[model samples]
Target: MPLSINSIAPDFKAHTTEGMIQFHDWLGDSWCVLFSHPKDFTPVCTTEIGSVAKVKDEFDRRGVKLIGLSVDPVAEHMRWAGDILAATGQSPNFPMIGDPDLRIAKLFGMLPEDATGDSASRTAMDNATARTLFIIGPDKKIKLTVSYPMTTGRNFDEVLRVIDSLQLTARHQLATPANWISGEDVVIVPSVSDETARQRFPGGWESPVPYLRLVGMPS
Candidate 1:
């Protein structure tokens, strides 16, 4: 079955650029962004990896750990890091999981269980479905998932924005409006009755419509 939001992310043991890791154990108590690429040494993937490396500090500040996956061996990933550095001025600072056998990709629903072949013989198009990203919260449940095509590089800034909304909504009974960013006003979830909302937001809220109550983000 395809994984869904709120489902516990599948765990696996894999070889990474850093070393071997048991996925859930490596995640520990931090939020995590587990992004994958179809193959190593590809141009678009190289830039994507470098982009994450550049803004790694932003993720770190939000208590998010970043890990990458590619359908190639660790040695290949290491070699590709140099090219990534040369092209984008940043090499990946996080562990890059080597999914040469497609085990982790299959477990995470990024590939079919019947998918065949080792990374040695597979082209990027052969593993195209592996271009995916997952955001797992401290509770080990998936909070978000996104998949991009071979031609599109992801926008990590937008990922960060969603993380901000996820963290904020999780803490309070609120839901972010369209294109919401941090410090923007949010809507109280309908589950919170007006009486309860009054107690929660003693400062009051703006009700342009009965079902749409907007309140400033709480400190």
Candidate 2:
């Protein structure tokens, strides 16, 4: 079965553009965004990778580390980075993992355990399901996951928005409402008792229903 939100993110070691990294060790005490592409040098994947590189600083400020995976080996990954740099004029600011053996892909359940091959012998169609994004929390559990079709480019901005929501909800006792952005009102987590709510939000909240208490973003 594919890994789901709240499940512990499986750890593995792999070669990357920067160097070798052991998944959980790289994540030590920080949130992480681990994204994957079917292969190196694909047009859509190129744009997606460049986009993530552009906003890497935004993720860093939010205490989130960014890592990418592609089924291609290190040499191909290096070659592709040249194309990525030439096309976008933005250097990839984060590591792109070289999963030539599909180890990480299988570990994350992005591919069948039976899937095999180095990028040389395999084509992008062979690993099409590998287009996925994973957000792991400091606790080492997956906070969110999104999988995309080969033709559809992943949205890093929406990913940033989700990170904002996840970080806020983790620190506060409230949940974001539909289309909620930072600075908007938040709903009380169902478990926070009315008595406890009174203690936490001394200013009180707007209760459309007894259970639907809406309050300002936490200080």
Candidate 3:
């Protein structure tokens, strides 16, 4: 079955550019962003990889770890680093998992269980469904999942914005509003009653409607 929000992220052992890793152990006590590409050396994904490298420090600032996956061997991923650097001037500074056998891809439900063959024999189209991103919390539960079509490049800035919102809302009983970014007013989740909200937001809140109470971003 496909993973959903709140599902415990599946754990696995794999060969990454950084060496062998047990997924859960590598992710101990931190948020994580695990994104995948259809293949190594692909155009759009190369730029995406470089983009992540450029923003890695921001992710680190937020206590989030970044990792990537591609449907190729680690050697190919290493070789592609040169291309990524040439194209975007930034090479990946994080581990990149090599899914040559599609083991991790199928385990994460990115590809069908019946999918077969090593990445060496498959074309990019054959692994198109592998383009997905997962955001996991410190508890190792998936907080979000996004799959992109092969032709589109992902907006990683929005990914950072979401991480900010996720971290904030997780710490407080609030829900971000549409197009919300950090430091903006947030809505009190409906489950938080007025009485509870009062105690939490003792300074006060703005209620344009009965249930749509808006309050400043909590520190």
Candidate 4:
């Protein structure tokens, strides 16, 4: 089954580039961005890791710890870390979990069993370790999950943007609009009844459409 939001995220102990780390124990109280790539030393994965390295500080500022996972061994991760530094001139400060046995992958439901008959395969597109992204809250719940094909590169900007939105929403009770961006006006979760709407949103509610109630305010 797919992992559910607002539920405790699956925990695990696995080998990583930085060494062994227990999921909840190591993650501490920080939000987490856990992603998986097809394998180490591939072209697309190389670029993806490089981009994430460049924005490492941004993630740090937002109190989000980044972790990477793949079915490759720790030795492969070490070699790839060298490659990433040589290619990008920056070492990965984050942990790259060495899931050669797919232990952590199975816990997080990263594997698409029916698609690949168990274990994430390098050949499958939607299933397997073919570039999966997950945003887990500090509360240990998964907030969002995204999967992509191995051939295409991930949208780094979108990842950061969504992180910003999620963080902001968590701190303040507000909702992000469609294609919502930082500094853009946020919508308030509306009440079902007209009387409740007036009580909760005293400023007044405008409905451009029946189901669409918008409140323009800073978040």
If ranked by lDDT, best first, what sequence of candidates would result?
Answer: 3, 1, 2, 4
Give the Cα lDDT of each candidate: 0.94, 0.90, 0.95, 0.76
- Model 2 spans with C-alpha error above 4 angstroms: none
Off by over 4 Å in 1: none
Query: What number of clashing residue pairs does each candidate have, in the order they appear?
Result: 0, 0, 0, 0
Work out the TM-score per prediction. Answer: 0.99, 0.96, 0.98, 0.84
lDDT of 4 at 123: 42
Q: Say which candidate scores most in lDDT.
A: 3
Give the alpha carbon lDDT tens digit for every residue of 44-81 in model 4.
77778878989989899888899988667878888898
lDDT of prediction 4: 0.76
lDDT of 1 by residue, 1-219 (tens): 899899999989989999999999999989999999999999899999999999999999999999999999999999999999999999889999998998899999999999988899889999999999999999999999999999999999999999999989889899999999899899999999999999999999999999999999988
Off by over 4 Å in 3: none
> Higher-lDDT candidate among 2 and 3?
3
Report the lDDT tens digits of candidate 3 across residue range 31-141: 999999989989999989999899999999999999999999999999999999999999889999999999999989999999988898999999999999999999999
Q: Point out the worst 10-residue segment of candidate 3 by lDDT.
A: 203-212
